[model samples]
Target chain A: MSVIEIKNLTRDYGGKGVFDLTLSVESGETFGFLGPNGAGKTTAIRHLTGFLKPQKGSCAVNGLDCWAESPKIHGSLGYLPGEIAFFDDMTGLDFLNFIAEYRRVKDKTRMRSLLERFELDARGKIKKMSKGMKQKVGITAAFMHDPAALILDEPTSGLDPLMQSRFIELILEENKRGKTILMSSHMFEEVERTCRRVAIIKNGRLATVDSIDKLKAAQVKKYVITLENEKAALAFAKEFAEEDVSETRVTVSIAGNIRELISQMNKYPVAGISMPGQSLEEIFMQYYGGNKNV
Target chain B: MFNATLFKSGIKGGIKTLALFCAVLTMYYLIIVQMFDPALGKMVQELAAAMPELMAIFGMNLNSATLTGFLASYLYGFIIIMFPMIFSILSVNRLIVRHVDGGSLVFLVAAPIKRRDVAFTQMTVILSGLLALTLYVSVLGIVASEISFPGELETGKFILLNLGALALHMFIAGICFLSACIFNETKYSVGIGAGIPVLGFIIQMLSNSGEKLEGFKYATFFSLFSTDGLIAMRPNAVWGMVALFFCAIALFISAIAVFTKKDLHI
Candidate 1:
């Protein structure tokens, strides 16, 4: 059964809110919500979390209607807001304890584990904590309950790369334990790493919803082939359609056609080989019409 | 429906401001209670008769020689009325408007408590704080007066005065709380939250300008309680209290309804 369901949830904020959006996350499946800023990512999550009531349709969590049965569903779900707004005078420890108390968790084992895993000391006043530290506090509060489902809005935002990777590892570990997770993020790499299926929202509309494997399979991989000399590279470039036909370098972009390229490359005197840094942007670009809203 | 945790935090967060206002009121109330003299009251009456406009602005009655009249005109008239209105406005703004604007309310609602519960808890906190402040200051003032000058201060009249002040604050707090629930942005929320009470204070002041505008007192939320009138149990005082009670309940209902259904798209 689906742990989360949003059907035709529309809340018009001057033609900017989510419109006719329909999506669902199966129990134990980590679903990723991908979208640019102001693209209704946070708005949709708010409805699922029951912070915002839908004007048009419905969002449900754990088979309970979101708007009608909000408090009931919140007991089984954990949520992190896009921006952490902590009490001005409280320490991180105080904030975590308050949330734990509210959620009625008896054992502090999970809270302690989350704190240690995130490397958060949680002793200083939140007002004094750095943005990354505050984000760590938010992450800790959201996961400490060990709820059956979690909704995180740009959860990895504001963390350093090391912390971001740790967060991805944590999500993977939690998802392995059969927790239903729905996370919204503009960071494609993090989404690719942790999510099984992803839905892309652009300008308050769903652009695409597909499995990560299929999306990755459909991505264009670029290989920059360097020949022994400019003459060979030029001749090789002529035989094959390429991006940059320089003196000794020819860049090939294709969707999983490395076998065809390998046959064509063998006929030339290959000098060096390299691929530029990889990005999910290459495939996501088509949805945005080359506007790289990243 | 109220969540214990949210209500506790609401009271906890408001204690500092509430205490500060209470301390200031306590010190001033005690000082004046100690300073109360029959001779001073007579002198104040003479001054008020000479400058009726100045006296009316403070809601001063002509009978200033009595202990009840002295406190009513001197304390309850302007400072007492102004302070509680400010406290109510500030408390609601902090407890509701600020949290909503800052997006911290999302965290509270993100808990098992529904949005309605969160709003209810906040309403309870604001109401409780104002009630506590009224009770504490009244008790402290009476205690200080009894210790300093036994049987000199009118206890019955003072209690009546406090009730009137409490009712007025109840109504003012409702307006501020309702304002907090109506708007989402900090600027607009706090603007209305603070604006309404401040406007009432101004109207109350203007109504005291002369007899021609005395009827305008009914237009202000603060008119529910006049310390002098409450002590005397005037006919209008009963109607004022009744009016405030109904308006407060209606505003409270609207506040909860609006907050429960408002779009918190954080």
Candidate 2:
């Protein structure tokens, strides 16, 4: 059974809100919501958290309505908002304790473990903390209750690389404990690492939903080849109809025919070859760009 | 529905402001009580007669023959009403509008507490603060009157005056809370929340300035309190207090309803 569900949800704010949005996350599965800023990622997530009342359809969690039964739904759900705004007057520890008190969490064991794992010194005032430190506090607050389901919006946005990896490790650990997780982010690498299935949204509409492996399989691979001379590079560029050629370097994109590229490259003298990491931006441009129908 | 954690935090946030207002009230009430001599009352009445227009504008038209009348004329007219109105505006805005505008309210609403419960807790905070302020002033008035003039103060009439003032300020707080709940921006909340009461006070002052401007009294809710009438035990004074009390409850109930159903962009 799905742990979280949003069906035909529509809240039109003039021209900028989600319309007919539908998605579901099964129990114990890590689902990714991928979108650029202002693509209604937060809007859809707000509905699931019951911060928004759906104008048309419905949002439900654990077989209860998100809007009407929000308090009940919140009993088993943990959320980290996209924008982390804390009570600036209180220390991070005080803020966490306040949330714990409201959540009726008697066991401080999980809270202490999360604080230790994140290496967060929660003594400083939240307003005085750096963005990364505030993000760490937000992460701890979200995970302290050990909820059955987690909804994280751009969870690792303000973290350093070390903390980002630590957050990824935490998510993986939570996933191992059979927790249902729905994480929304525009960072392709993090989503690639954590989510098994991803749904891409564009202009408040669902563009595509597929497994990460399939998307990776269909990724366009770009290879930059440096030949012995400019003449060889020009020859290779002409042969492959490649436009990104400069001096003795020629860049070519291969969709799936790597053997054809290898056979074609054997005819030229290759001085050096390098492949850049594939980004989601290139994938979007190749597949979902310019075609609104998709 | 109530959330104790939220209520505690709300009280903690507004306690300092409440304390400051209480201290100010205590000083003003004590000093005013001390100045209640028969000779001084005659001299002040002569001065008020010479500048009747100015004195009337400040609601100083009461007969200052007794301690109750003296306190009612000097304190209840402008100081008590205006100070408590200012306190209601500032604290109500802080309790609800500041949290909603600054986005800290998301943390509270995202908990297991219902939206109505959050609004109710904030409303309770504002009411409790107002009650504490009113109670302090009442106790201070009786104690200062007893200490200064030993049984000269009419305790029953004084208590009635304070009850009327409390009812009036509760109505004022309802306006502020309603504004806070309706608007998501702090500027709008403060604008409408503070604007209505301050504007009413000005209108009431205008109407009190002269007989030609008497019709302007109908334009402001401040005219309903009628401090002199309540001190003299008029029947209409009791009815006005009842009306103000019911209106306050209705506004508060509507505020919670609006907050529960509204879509929070935070």
Return the top candidate by DockQ.
2
- Candidate 1 residue-wise lDDT, A118-149, digit = tens: 89899999999999999999998888888899
Model 2 misplaced regions, further than 4 Å:
A222-241, A246-252, A256-281, A288-294
Tens digit per residue, CA lDDT, model 2, A17-67: 898989899999999999888899999999998988999999999999999
Q: Which stretches of model 1 miss by more than 4 angstroms?
A: A222-252, A257-282, A285-294, B211-215
* Quality of model 1 by C-alpha lDDT: 0.84
Worst 10 residues of 2 chain A by lDDT: A285-294
Clashing pairs in 2: none
Cα deviation of A194, candidate 2, in Å:
0.5
lDDT of 2: 0.88
lDDT for each candidate structure: 0.84, 0.88
User: Taking the tens digit of each residue's C-alpha lDDT, what string does model 1 give over B136-218?
Assistant: 87898679878877776788878878877887788888888888898888788778877877877888887897888888877
Give the C-alpha miss distance for residue A251 in model 2, angstroms.
4.6
Q: For all the predictions, what are the DockQ values? A: 0.62, 0.69
